[model samples]
Target: MKENQHLVHHDATTKTRHGQPSTSPTSIVFNAQPFGGGPGATLTAVMPYLRSRLKSLGPIALHYVGSSLTMDFQKLTETKWDGIHNVDLYTNPEIGKRKLVSLLQHLKPQLVVTAMDELVAAAAQAAGIPVVIIDLLLWFWPSISPNWRQAELVIAAEFYGVQERIISENLNNVATVPPLGPPARTTQDPSADVLLNFGGMINPLMPKQEYIAYSHLIYSAARRAIELRNAALPESQHAKLIVLVASFDVAQGIDPKDPEAARMVLPDEALKLMASSELTFCTAGLGNLYAAGAVANAVLLLPPLHEGHAIQTHLIQKAGVPVDAIEWHELTGRAPIDYYRDSLQVMDNVSKAQSEVIDSPQAQTALVGRMLAAMLRSASAGVSAEDPPLRTLIKEFGQDNGDAMAVQIMDVLEKVR
Candidate 1:
């Protein structure tokens, strides 16, 4: 049967002596953009795992496409690439498309891997290269929608157990990979206190009343946690309550240079202040989650998103992190004051739940290894490698601590099944 050619574009020169255009048996190019927020941090944290995965592919040239605004990609570019192109595709899809088309024509990658960016995928498919779409979050945007039927494969984090069902129903090829925990950070004492952090661009459609209400809810929740801790513990032993608000530099309906508009938005100094706190209270977004995970335990207060909020929430909770559900109404009203008064009870419940499921570091490393293995296996299958030895590659990358991490990942996978 002819493959579904709609999703990928192919060159007229169909046959090559080697797997790819060059002498190399197989070549894959990864097109990843910088994640703007918590998801970005999650992606950044998983870089080690990704690097390990790339190593498993054996001297394959990996090209990461990203914006110039973030410097994180600088270290990645030091490695030799068949080619490297940096452009703000997310901000300017038209220019991105033109540049990406040029890259595909020049690189002729056998496989292209990306998070769901439809324009890039469509272009790759138009070039006849197989595309793999990783849906990092549960939500789907109409603008950059995935055409699963056209994609060679689709991979999603295991936190979205339902995704397998969704994909099976909608797409021909699909796989579910477990959440590889955030990349390791410098060790520090996990803060004993509760921390809160929230982020996202304020919705322009959201009325001024709505923003005020949301801020009020957060304030009330923080105040309540404080009251509960103080009342439950002796004044000396009470845990500190810290609130960090990581606001987007962009504001709704505001001019960039307007001081008054800037004042209306949350300040950078405020975010720094919040980061310094022991605990963070914030809505569920990638930036806030990573910041919390990077520094301390968090009390994740998820805000509603049109899509993917539930999946994101599940991943956060599954990581053995503490989280609480505060209704939009509660946040908008002063009722959170009373809620915080009862926070000691709520926090205790969350803490207990977190302790039971938090995977050990060894387990996390193994999970990371497994995810890389799966991606490599998929890539190998597409390129028709003869039983490639990925295990050895993983060990070479220093992930062979033991089968403990793999065992833990399998256990989680089974539970999801």
Candidate 2:
């Protein structure tokens, strides 16, 4: 809270207003992990808002450390941090820590923000620096990393983390963050076709080979869906079947023969595509799924082979994602194409059957798909169970919270100052 007796100025490259220059009164360090695309994307989505808020309050220095060995940090170069470092956590943990600490001490930031990374969180707290930990995984409360437990503050997102976050919210220095991301597309052409998106699976929970196979299955299914749609209607009536791949998903094979069939886009681009999709079949990572429900008329999920896939899927579904949103067939091996082909019909039949059982006296919440229902229910319902929470969240946080995570961190920075 005391003023820094030691004068330190890291000239930020981000031009405040055209030719005008600004000096940061405080520094904030961000340790970002882009491995699964969730953390990195979340950070980027919120960074602009965070910067805007920080600038209004006063000049504040920004610094970033990309915890990836092979990822091109060039993607984030636009962030214009006073300083940026890319370190390999898996290969050289000690060196990475040392480099990170040195940068932290030099900047002497007012606070540090980490995306579910324990080591970086721990290091910052160890230095007596205030830390705001972002809990994207919604990890078990008791099982939460000790590093996160020590934060000056922790913000668990509303949807992907709402369940465990209830417990996290009560924990020392923790609170529930409104669903965080850029504005989603609301205008929908209900008649739009499907978007076969698997997210940027650059970091696969499953083996690379297996990931490719599963991705191929989805791609092939998407292609077939296009054909079926073309045949089912006149050529002029055919709908768009766009497949947005990850920047790193080069092996998914975008089918050069049909160059328009697929293409790789940045994380933000993928999110917009998913939100604007009419029907979406995407990998069930928290990052991808959270953005999928925005405006899509129908959304079915496929889980990447991950150890925590079951729990991650369970929590979201419990929040009222419906019995059909999660496509379990892909993981169980019935062929993903079948799930995509009759998905609409399948969802209608399944929802009615599930609802019937749900209304039965003998039914239990543990019914195989009890919590699940096909997302095919028309958007006419206006507000699904999940929608209210997000709707309330947006109202509570405003159209945006300047990147909910950063906004919260800035509060801490201001308080101590």
Candidate 3:
């Protein structure tokens, strides 16, 4: 694990503090999806487990590859990471890949661990670095990329259609892991009645104005729904809603002191808060759904915020899961299921699939109605089952396999070491 001083300074927001590069004997690079916080959160959650397993190697260098779109890199600041490389893959893929490859070549790491960032993993493999790709969205990949086929290992989160896709792809190197998210709470007391968490509320390809509108629509609807629900209860029994966002862009211009306004926090802190909440209302992201479901007592999914979100929301509903979802049709009046599939064709563009809803005058009104309905249903239904729908989601999708993934990475590192 030798470092090149010049490469260390190449657009690195976080770097080792040594006056001279150390000559550590082993190194690893952890790269995560630049767009969403979920992939990065999974990678970070696995690090502690991986780190403990690799401690015998004695001071191995850890490098993180991330982007500005997410707060993933911030979570690694307190960890034993030596360098953080922030690249702009969305604005310029070729240049980002070049920078990434150059960094990998300089570090010459023993292994590369990536979560949903196929391009980064591919860059590493092209540079002769062993790669581990974490497919958090394994449930919905219609086709496999050649880049994935070449990876040293693929750790996939198990879901309904996951095994079928893996079998179809003939991916011998793949390992089916459980749903990944924030670890469960041990002794935390319930803090909020309902938590409104919208994970990584930005898509690079989506227009900023459109995202602003979308975020506000969801936030306002959720807040109003909770308010209406609370109005029906005794003053002491009123349910509280706390809006959590990774960026202020999701809910801007509100007093930070306002309990109902959005408050920006790190991924881990947000999950910790989720564990203490009675109910979690979030977007239909695989990572978000799993993390919230695994920890919170009750979980209800909000509508699709992106194309990938649209697919996952539809799949969850199709699977006949008992969890409630504010579907795309309710908000957009676009029930043509094929529309979601067609959106997948242009999925690479990564824009909002429900443009009709975003542009509609009644979008916010519809969301309010749906959210209030869901809240009222939950309040009236009370606790019905021993194992809730959230648990059902966890049973259907695999359990948290962060530790298993860490062990696998450690095994690879041990072989190389």
Question: Tens digit of lDDT per residue, candidate 1, span 8-127?
Answer: 232111222223334443445555534433322233344334445444345454455544312233332233333344645665678777877876776667677665555667888888
**Per-model TM against the reference:** 0.49, 0.69, 0.85
Best by TM-score: 3
List the global CA lDDT of all models. Answer: 0.42, 0.55, 0.69
Write model 2 residue lDDT over 37-103, tens digit each, in one string: 6666666666777888777766676666664311333253255554555654545679767766776
lDDT, model 1, position 40: 28
Question: How would the candidate models be sorted by lDDT, starting from the highest?
Answer: 3, 2, 1
Model 1 scores a TM of 0.49
Highest lDDT, which number? 3
Error of 2 at 67 (Å): 3.7
* Better-scoring candidate (lDDT), 1 or 2: 2
Superposition error at 186 for model 1 (Å):
17
Residue 66 in model 2: lDDT: 64
